[model samples]
Target: MSRPFLKMNGLGNDFVVVEARSKPFAPSAEDVRAIADRERGVGCDQLVSIEPSARADAAVRFWNADGEEVGACGNASRCVGWLLMEASGRDEAVIETRAGLLKATRAGERRVSVDMGEPGLRWDQIPLAEEMDTKGIELQVGPIDAPHLHTPGCVSMGNPHVVFFVPDAEAAPVREVGPLIEHHPLFPEGVNVGFAQIKARDRIRLRVWERGAGLTRACGTGACAALVAAARRGLTDRKATLELDGGELVIEWREADGHVIMTGPAEVDFTGTLP
Candidate 1:
């Protein structure tokens, strides 16, 4: 059976969006892998499916390139929001993910704003193996004689992230330490590792090593997690612009509702039909 799919990107983190709102299509692990195969299939960093939500909006299911279902996906949410608006003709909509409900709005010609909800800061919230403050946790990786990176802030944006604030993100060992930190013992569940460089009070640079997927162009939740980590440490303002490898994202930790609002662009690359 052939199915229609949309190729979209949020700051270059691409996705294959399948609209299954009318009926749920639960793709198996193998099926998901097949669909995300670069050469043999519809290829994407993630596969997003939109389904009917009990909360009066829509539910988005995310699968990584490895075919594992994930709790949250920021870029995918924007793509889902765009698809929902285009189909329903509404400027605003709510999307339900495994993490929680996210409010989104069509902010520009090809941009969408999503309220990513509140961030989780507790040790258990981040689900680390042992209890330690989210502010800083001791997890080292690299050479046993000379560890490269240590003491990172662990936070959750509906998913686990380990952020290491450095002086220069570009110089930091993203490729060297990212994979090690991601599989470190502290994180029972593998984590998305980020090397964050604070450029100014409201601007930062980031490079991410995703859990299920390796280094990607960008990661929205990773960016949000980084900003929250910085804000809690009094390092950055509540609102800042995150410069990722792929593009930029505006993140605001609203004092009123404690919700983290992520505003960025979502572009449709192309549409494909399943064979």
Candidate 2:
């Protein structure tokens, strides 16, 4: 039987969200690939499923376009949060995921703020093949004498991320080097690769090659990871505006509670029935 679904986007990082609170919706890898196919199906960066939760408002699952189930997706969480709040007529919503419980609140018109929780800075937390300094791991690409990208800060915002600070984000070879670093041996479980250019103490430009999703217009967790990594490296302040290709996200690594708060816009493109 066909199912109703919502098409939503946060900063242009789009998703196909299915409400499974009443019925279980488990799609196989092939099914997810077909659903996310650009030519034959409703194309999206990820497919999100919202299910009933005993502890939180709902439980959310994320699957990349490549059909791999992942731990978390910040943009999808915000979108789902908005859906829950609208349905319940409440200002705040809690959504559970493999990463953990996330709380989102209405920030403004069509805007939502999510508490992404604390970042994992340890090597084992990032889960590299070997323990190393997370501030700047020993990974490099391009010619050995003159590497194009090197010494990236590592952090885990639910999922593993590596942030490479470059002089110019546009000049960085994201498409060319992204896949290489994603599959690097150092990252046993693979990782999201981010190319960031620090615009100022409170601003940054970022592009991300999401694990199993390739390069997306925006990556919410990537933005949070970038801010945390930048702050740890003393490159930027704890709070910064991350400018992505699709739009901008405000990320703040709160010191008191050590939680990362991400504020951004969520849009509903349309609603339809899944074939």
Candidate 3:
């Protein structure tokens, strides 16, 4: 039987979303690989499944292009939220995920704002291999005397992340270094890597290497993590506009609630049926 699906994107981070509430869609790792393959299947950074939920509007799950199941995906959440609101003709949508409950609201036009919840600051919270200061971990690359990258602040916005504040984000070696840090011994679980260059107290230029999805045009959680990491390092304010490869996302680490709010645009690229 053919299953209908939606092709969506949030700041060029694309996804193939299937509504599985009624039919119960469960794709195995191989199945996911076939669907996410750019040359042979529908191209996307990840695959999102929207399922039935008793606690919220829907329950969402994510799988990377490598067919690895992940706990959270901020960009996909926004896309799913936009779809939910559009279908219900409502301004808000609540969602459940492996990470936790998340709420999405219409910001303006195609823009969406998601409450990413408080960041995990502690070493154990981030679940590092050993106890240490997450603000700047003692990991380095290149020569010992003068390492290329060092002291990355780690945070968990549902998923683990490590942000390296750099003098130039554009010049950062993302593909070369991202995979290395992602599998570093310090992070028991693989980590998403981000390189950030502070433009101002309110602006930052960033690039991210997602744990399972590799380098993408944008990553919502990565943006949030970068802002929080920057704030923790006193490099930037509590909020900033993160300029990613695809576009910009405004991220705020709210002091009152400590909930990170991410605002960005979502779009419908097309639709197709899974054969």
Q: Which ten residues in a row have the lowest lDDT in candidate 3?
A: 118-127
- Looking at candidate 1, the ten consecutive residues that score lowest on lDDT are 140-149
Per-residue lDDT, model 2, residue 95, is 94
Q: What is the Å distance of residue 267 in model 3 from its true position? A: 0.4
In model 2, which runs have C-alpha deviations exceeding 4 angstroms?
A: none
Per-residue lDDT of candidate 2, residues 1-275 (tens digit) = 99999999998999999989999999999999999998999999999999999999999999999999999899999999999999999999999999999999999998999999999999999989999999999998889999888999999999999999999999989999999999999999899999999999999999999999999999999999999999998899999999999999999999899999999999999999999
What TM-score would each prediction reach against the true structure? 0.96, 0.99, 0.99
> In candidate 1, what are the lDDT values of residues 155-274, reduced to their tens digit?
899999999988888898878778777787888888999999999999989999998888989999999999999998888999999999889999999999999999998889999886
Residue 5 in candidate 1, Cα distance off native in Å: 0.5
Distance (Å) between predicted and true CA of 124, model 3?
A: 1.5
Model 2 TM-score is 0.99
Candidate 3: list runs displaced more than 4 Å: none
What overall lDDT, based on C-alpha atoms, would model 2 receive against the true structure?
0.96
